[model samples]
Target: MMKQLKTLLIAATLLFSTSQVIAQAKIAHVDTNEIMSKMPAMMEAQKQLDNLQKTYDKEFKTMVDEYQSKLEKYNREAETVTEQLNTERAKEVQDMEKRIQDYRQTAQKELNQKEEDLMKPLMDRAKAAIEKVGKAKGYQYVINSTGLLLADGPDLTTDVKKELGF
Candidate 1:
């Protein structure tokens, strides 16, 4: 009975030690916001997005100006024109307003799509760099510091930025 008790105690001690070693996970944190802000590719992507938005804004302004001028001309001619001509002008103005609305909607959709297309690759690159750094550095868990209330782990944002080559 004494020998049996010694064997059981030894087995329990071995199990506890193994479990303790396994529990010591290498945790790390990263601020993706910081990493992305420092990335050159992200900066270039943002510049391109801004330029695209400016182009869209210019085209939209032109359309609006044309619509306004046509409406003003129709209003001024309405007084001297025939009833049929006045009705036709009114229909034309309504059609122009509808077309403007449709164009604005389409432009918005296109801009959103363009932004998504431009951002996806940049975001994916950042994510890949973070993953690569975490694995290379033997981090079992990497948490984003952007949303963390308390982060006591070592920050890997700089490492990730380096891994991204910027």
Candidate 2:
């Protein structure tokens, strides 16, 4: 009977300690997407990216038009031109096509790099604000509630936005 009583006392102590630990672990959630959308710096970065995209589109269209014009000209002259000349024209067209493809790939890479370069800092800033607010509020964990189906914890979105000065 004494051994059983001691075991019961130990189990109660462990349960009480576990409950205290659980109560001390404060958690919160924030919507990073909302904060990013409301941020003026993010919007400005998006506008810059859009302008760069437009420039690339215009240049790509010009290259496509030039390629089509050359192709049509070559096709029209294929019958009148010597076989060797026609072959040379075909090779020239192939070279132009390769160049256009290379330009498109390079432009896409540049745009991706530019977007990373421009947005990384803004993202970092938002993350830091979230972290700062979470820490200041004594939260042990701060989850991003962007895609969360259920977030019943305290929301830190407004606090993070205020921290970011937006």
Candidate 3:
């Protein structure tokens, strides 16, 4: 009976100690999206991406306009050209259409790559700042509040922003 009582007491003590340790753990939250949006580097990167997209748009428009002009010219000349010449012109137009599609696809891929390249460093910087703040503040766990339905812990977004000098 004494041995059973001792075992029960030890188990109860362990449970209470574990709860106390959990209660002492410090938790905080940060909105990473908020931090990234406010970052000047990210803003500049967005502007650059926009400008690149505009450039691509302008080039695509030029190509489309040229294709339309050629198509119109072919239509006008269709009645005068020989059967063989008409067939060749149609093939040329088809080839031009294919090239235009390939160019658009390539341009889209390049733009996506550029955006990823530009954002990677900024994201890394934000992560580093978050880690620094979490360690300095003695946070056992730092949760991202952006996706949380209920976040009542201390917000570390401002601290991370300050740490990044933004």
Candidate 4:
């Protein structure tokens, strides 16, 4: 009987302590997308990306127009020129087309790289602010609410935004 009593006592103590720990674990959620969208630094970074994209688009359009003009000229002259000259012009057009494609691919890669360079710092700053706010609020876990279907915990978005200073 004494052994059974001691076993029950130990089980009760363990259960109580586990409950206490669970109750003390504070969780919070934040809408990171909302925070990032409102961030001034992010807005500036977006503007820079947009401008770069526009520049790339304009340059690409010019190249496309030039390629089309040359293709048309070669097609029209194909009958008048000798077979060798026509073949050479066709090869030149093919080379120009390849160059245009290569330029487009290079531009896309450069734009992606530029976006990463510009946005990485802003994203890091936002993440730090969120961490700071979460720690300050005694949150053990801070989940991003973007993908959450249900977030009944306290919201840390406002606090995080404030920490980031708009």
In candidate 4, the residue pairs with backbone N, CA or C atoms under 3 Å apart (3 or more residues apart, or in different chains) clash, namely: none
RMSD after CA superposition, every candidate: 7.8, 5.4, 5.4, 5.6
lDDT of candidate 4 over 1-166, digit per residue (tens): 9999999999999999999997889989999999999998889989999999999999999989998998898888888989999888889888988989999999999999999999889889999998999999889889999999999989999999999887
lDDT of 1 at 126: 90
lDDT by residue (4-52, candidate 3, tens digit) is 9999999999999999998899989999999999999999999999999
Model 3 CA deviation exceeding 4 Å by range: 1-24
Off by over 4 Å in 2: 1-23
- After superposition on all CA atoms, how large is the RMSD of candidate 3? 5.4
Pairs of colliding residues, candidate 1? none
| TM-scores vs. true structure, each candidate | 0.80, 0.85, 0.83, 0.85
lDDT of each: 0.88, 0.94, 0.95, 0.92
Candidate 1 residues lying further than 4 Å off, grouped into runs, are: 1-23
Pairs clashing within candidate 2: none
Evaluate residue 71 in candidate 4 and report its C-alpha lDDT on the 0 to 100 scale. 89
Full candidate order by lDDT, most accurate first: 3, 2, 4, 1
